[model samples]
Target: MLHVNGEAFEVRDAAVGESLLFVLRERLGLMGTKGACEQGECGSCTVLIDEQLVCSCLVLAAGAQRQRITTIEGIATETPTDVQRALVDAGAVQCGFCTPGLVVAAHSLLERSPRPSESEIREELSGNVCRCTGYGRIIDAVQRVAVSRASAREVGL
Candidate 1:
């Protein structure tokens, strides 16, 4: 059995050794999770399993069974997590290939550290590689999100 995107599924008879990335993009059509490198080195396949970021390409689909997994689609459909909106407003998106994974990583970081410092943001996102934006803009985006979220919390907004 599997529960994905707020839905229940019966996968008891399904294959036992498929990567979560394959099941997501091939079976479920959730292609927001990129398949870059196909290895765990690049964080492009990042997804949240029980709110912790993991490389879907390296994770077994069976291991994700019953766990709450969040992908780029899930985040985009919501109110655009503060990190996402900041990324856009900060002009951090270029090429756009790495945005989804970066967004997922940022979401995990914010969930755990809410007010992460610049160095923390850099360290957290080090695994994700971006060919455009030169990373300066990406760091700025994360910092912007952290600041904006802090302000919102202070005013109870």
Candidate 2:
């Protein structure tokens, strides 16, 4: 059993040896956790296991047992997450293949360090590769989100 997106899902024995990414996409139909390089280089299959970032493709299904796995689908409630909205507003999303992972990574970073510097943001999101963009815009997106979130917190929003 895996608790994902605040829902309990049972994984059949047939998928015991599969990767978490496989289980999330094929069996559970949670395609927001995209899988690009199965080797964990692309970072497209990134997910928050107990609030810690990990590549779903490299994480064995059984290894994620009892962990609080949060995917892109669980990042926001009624509207898109602040990170997601910032990415789109900053034009950081290009082909969108890497958008989900980027959003997840940004959310994780912001959760840990709400006011990360530009250098810190780059270091945190370095694992996520975006072939389409040069990453300048992505950095801008994360910065924008961090700034606005701080502003909101100050006002108790």
The best candidate in terms of lDDT? 2
Q: Which ranges of candidate 2 are over 4 A from the true structure?
A: none
Which candidate has the top score in TM-score? 2
Our tally of clashes for model 2 stands at 0
lDDT of candidate 2 vs native?
0.89
lDDT tens per residue, model 2, 1-157:
9999889998775456899999999988998889988998999999999889999999998888888999988986579977888888998998999999988899899889988998999899988999998999999998898888889889999
Q: Let me know the TM-score candidate 1 reaches against the reference structure.
A: 0.91
In model 1, which regions exceed 4 Å deviation? 10-15
lDDT tens digits, residue span 1-157, model 1: 5566677666544577888888888778788899989888888899888877889999889888779878888777757777778889999998889999999898888889988888898899998989888899999998888888889889999
